[model samples]
Target: MSEDDRTRAMRSPGDGRPLPQRPADGLRSGGAPAHRMPGGGPGAPTHQLPNAAPQGPPESGPKPGGSRVYGRERSGSSPIKPLRSRREPSESGPPSPRGPGRRISGRTVLKIVAGVLVVLLVTVVGLFFWVNSRLAGIDGVLADYEGRPADTPGTNWLLVGSDSRKGLTAAQRKKLATGQAAGQRTDSMMLLHIPEGSDKPTLVSLPRDSAVTIPGKGRDKLNSAYALGGPKLLVRTVESVTGVYVDHYMEIGFAGFVDIVDAVGGVEINVRQAVDDPKAGLKLKKGTQVLSGSQALGYVRTRKGGALPDFERTKRQRQFLSAVVKKAASPGVLINPFTAIPLASSATAAVEVDSGTGAFDMLSLGLAMGDSPVTTVVPFGGNEAVPSGGTAVKWDRMKALALFDALKNDKPVPKDVIDAG
Candidate 1:
C-alpha cells in the first residue's frame, strides 16, 4: 500500500483522542505491571481501563488483590526465596512463648527421693521380721539344774559342739566319718567369756575328756555329765568346775554344723601343717585353704596322727569356730539372702539352747564372737590313763583357778595363765 494511505489508516482512528501518561522509569509505582484494557490504548472514550490492577506507591502494604510486593523491585526475572522451617523474628525481639523448653520442679524431685527411701525402709524392715521368725526357741533345757553360781560381771556362754548324729543318715555318717556313736556326746566345749568392758572376749576350750567330778557321778570324763543328765547336769558340772556362772548354753550337732558351713559357701582356714586323717575324713595341704561343709567338719574333728590328740583337736576346733563366725558375719553371707536365710534356718534348727537363751541372747553371742576371741585351752597337767582305762585330761589346778577368777571378775588373765592354757 502507498505510505500516504497506511499513515492515514493508522493515525486517522485516534487523531482526536487523549493518550495516558507513562512514568519516567519503566517500573510502575506499586511494583506491579501497569495494565490496561485490550482496545483502549489511547483512551478513545476516556473510560478507566476495565479489569486493570491498582498502581499505588511501592511502600504500600499489599495489592488490593491479595498479592505481596517485596521490598526491592526486581530487575528482570523473579527468583523464589527458600521457606524457613520457623519464622525468625527481629534480632532484638523477645523469645517466642512456645520456644523456651520444659524444666523439672524441686517438689517433684523430692517426692521421687521420698518414694525411693520408703521402698528401701520397707524392704529392710520386712527382712528383719523374716529373720526374727526363723530363730528356733529352746525351752526348759536348763530348768532342772539348781545351786548354779550367781550372775557375774560379764556374760559366759557354754558353746558345745556335740557329736550327736540326730539328723544324719547312714550315708551322711559314713561320708563324715562320724562313727555310729549311739548317744550324744560333747565333741567340743568352750567357755566364751565376754568381759563387761572393752577387754576382748576370751574363748577357753574345755577338753571333753577332762577328768571332772560329775554332780552325783563322782570323778569322770567331763562329757559324761551331758550324756547322763543332759544340759542341766552338764551346766552344773561346768559351773562347779570353773566357778564361773554359765548363763547360756548353746549346742550344735554334727549334721547342723556341716549344713551351716555349706550354706555360707565355705569356711576359709589357714592350716599350719598338712593334715591327712582318715578317721575324720580330712586331707588338706598346709596353706590358706577354703574348706567345704564336709571338709570343715573333718578339719575340726580330726584327732588322729597328732602327738597330743585331744589338745591338738581342741586347738583345731577353736580355729575352725573362729573361721565360722567370721564367715557368717561377712557380707558374702549376711548381705546375700540366698546364703543368710538358709544358714540361719539350718543353724537354728540344728542348735539347742538353754531355756533362758532367747533370740536376742543368740544374736549378742554371735555378734560378740564375730570379733576375734582370744582362744586357749584350759591348762592341762597331763593326759594319763584313768581308773576307767580311757585317757582323761587333768587340768593344772593353780592356773585353772586363776583363769576362772579373771573371767568371773571381768579382769584380764595373767599372761602366764593365758599362755599356760
Candidate 2:
C-alpha cells in the first residue's frame, strides 16, 4: 500500500482526520499518528497522551494510583509521549505492548523472593548452632543416637543417688560430729513425669526405706535398687511399681547437685518451721530463705518437722521444690545470664540422661514442663515404720501406683491428695 493509504488507516476513526508527524524520541508511535493534540501540531503545547498507569492497590495497603497519576510533573518543552500501557485509542487500534519504560521481564520480583528465602535459611541455621553450642557434655559422649524422639506414653527418670561422703571436708565432717562413717546412704531420690494435659502431673515420692520386690535381689527398699544393680535396676523397679514404661533416666550426686544450685545463685525455699538439723549443720529460722547448695541439701532432708511419722519432711520437699520452680521462672533468675547459663551447664554436667535423649531432647522436655503442675507423690497412710525397726518406713505401693495411673489417664488426683494434712 502507498504511504498515504497507510496514514489514512492510522487516522482516528472517531473523526475523519489526517495522521500526525512522528517525534524522533517518542516511546510509542503508531504508524503516522505520532503527534496529534488539542492545539494541534509541532510546537502547540497540548495533551498528547495520558500518563503511565501504576500498579493496583495492595491488599490492606494504601493505593499509589492517584499519587502516580495526578502528581506527575510535566516538562515544559518536552512533548508528552504516551507510555504504551496508558495510550488511549480513539477507535483506532490497540497499542503495541512493549515500551521502553514498561516492564518486560519478572527479573526484579524473582530476585526479591530469592533474597527472602536466603535470609530465612540463615536465621534457622544460626539458631540451631547457638542451641547446640550451649548444650554441654553432649558432643561425642552421645553418638549412634540423634534424630530419635522418645516415643512413650510417659517418661520415667531415675534421679541419681550420690555418696555424700565425698562432699564433706574434714571440717564439715567434724561439724556434723560423725567422725566419717564409711559412706552415708544416698540422700535424695525422685522420679518426674510429663503426662498429657494442661496441668496434669503424677509424682510418686519413694522413701529411702520403702521395701519392694527387687528383680533378682529379692525384697528390699526401693533405694537399694541404685546400690544393687545401678540405674537399670532402678528403672525396672519403678516400672514394676507404676506399670508405666520407663522411657529415660537421670542421676546426680550430692556435689553435683550443690554445684548446680550454687551456680544458679542458690534456690529460695519458704519454710514454716525453723530448721535446725544437727546432722546437716543447717540452722536457719523459718521464713523465705535462700540457701546455698550445702544448706539446700539439708533443708530437703530434714525430718525434724514432726516427732513420729516424718510426714513433715515429705511436705517440706514439695514446698521447697515449688518455691524453686517459682523463683527460677521469675525475671530475676531468667534475666541473670551469668547465673542462668552456669546453672544450666552445671546441672547438665551433673545429670546423666537416658541412653537415647540428647541436649535438644532434654530441652524440649524442660520446655514442656514449664507450664505444667509439679507435685510430689504422697503415700496413702502417711509414712509408717516397720513394727520392729523404725529406720524402715513402709510406703504404700498400691497408692503410689494409683497416683501414677491417674497421671497416665490425664485425670486429677483426689482433692484429698492435694489437701493432705
Candidate 3:
C-alpha cells in the first residue's frame, strides 16, 4: 500500500483515533477516569448520599430554606465504583445522565441482534430470488432412468464423462479447441456411491473398458451406452450392471462444465504430476493450483495424462468435487445467498435428471454426501482381456450387488465391499 494509503488506514475516518477505537468511544477517554462520564462518578451521587439537610453561611446559597444548603464531605474516604447493576431504575432515583439505568439490557441487545438477522435473512432471500431470476435459458438436456440405492448401501451418483464432440459448428469447435467433431466413445465412467449407513462416501471408478452386459443392450463397452443412448441409457446400463439403483444423475458436457467452474470462481486442487496434454489443451506444473472451468474440464478429461491414465484425472475430479462441496456447505458461502445461486443454477441447469427430480431433493442429497468421507470403487481386481475390444474388469459381482442391496436397506456396506474392490 502507498504511504498515503497507510496513513489513511492509520487515521480514523473522522478523528485521528486508532482504527480499532470508535469515535464515540474516543470521546469518552479524555483525561477522565476510564469509567466516569459527564453523567457523574461512582455510586449514588453526593445528593443521594446521606447529608445534613442544611447549614448556615455564605458558602451555601439557600433562599427557600431558613438555613443554607451545603455540600457534605464524603464519609470515611470510601472509594466509589460506578453503579452497573441492571436492576437500577431511572425513575426510582433520578438516573445519572450516564444513567445507572439499564445500559441497553442484555435481553434488549439480543432482540436487536435478532432483528438484524431477520433483516439480513430477508435481504439474502431476496438476493437469491433476484439472481436466480437473472439466470435464463439454462435448461439443458434432461434424461432420466430408475436408480437403486447403492448395493454397497448409500446414495450413489453415476457420473458419465462423455467424449461427444459431434454436432458442433466450426466456431463452437474452435472455441473449446477440442478440434472437429470426432466421435469414438465416452472418455471415462465412474459409480459414485454413498453408503446407506456408511458414514464415509467411496468413489468406485469403473473402467470404461470394464466388461458388463447392459440390460437389453447385450454386452458392450460402458461408454457405448452413451453412444447408443445418452445419459439415460448410460445410467440405466450402470443400474443393470451393478444391481445398484442410481438416486440421481449429472451429465456435464465440455461447455457446461467450464461455465460451472467459472461461476463459483475456481477450485483448489492438488496435482501430483506435470500434466502435458496438447490434445486436451492442458499444460500445468505439478503442485497445488486453482483451476477454472476449462482447465478443470481438461483435468478430468485427459486420458493420457499420467502412467495410470484417466484414473488420475478421475481422482482429481473427485477431490475437486469435494472442495466444491466444502465451499458450498460453508455458512459464509451460503449466507451470501447470491453466490451459489448462479453456479448452482448454472450447474444443475445443465444436468439431466429423472422427470420428478428438483433442486431441494438434490441439495439435501448433496449435503448428506458432503458430510460423508468420499470413497472410490476402483477395484484392485484384475481385468480380463476382451476377445477384440478392451479388457473386461474382473469384479466380485455378488459382493458388489450385496453392497448395493445393503444400501437399499440402509445398512452398512460390508467392509469387504470396499476391501474386495
After superposing candidate 2 on the true structure, give the runs of residues whose Cα lies further than 4 Å from its correct spot.
1-152, 164-185, 329-332, 368-374, 380-391, 417-421
lDDT of 3 by residue, 243-330 (tens): 6667666555666666667777777778778888877778878999898777877777677565656456656666666676666666
Ranking by lDDT: 1, 3, 2
Best by TM-score: 1
lDDT of 2 at 374: 56
What is the alpha-carbon lDDT for the whole of candidate 3? Answer: 0.60
Lowest-lDDT window of 10 residues in candidate 1?
A: 41-50
TM-scores for all candidates: the values are 0.74, 0.58, 0.63
Instruction: Give the lowest summed-lDDT range of ten residues in model 3.
Output: 24-33
Please tell me which model should have the higher lDDT, number 2 or number 3.
3
What are the lDDT figures for the candidates, one per model? Answer: 0.80, 0.57, 0.60
Per TM-score, what order, best first?
1, 3, 2
Name model 3 segments beyond 4 Å from true. Answer: 1-111, 117-154, 164-177, 182-186, 195-198, 378-421
Candidate 3 vs. true structure, TM-score: 0.63
Score residue 114 of candidate 1 by CA lDDT: 100
For every model in order, what is the number of clashing pairs?
0, 1, 23
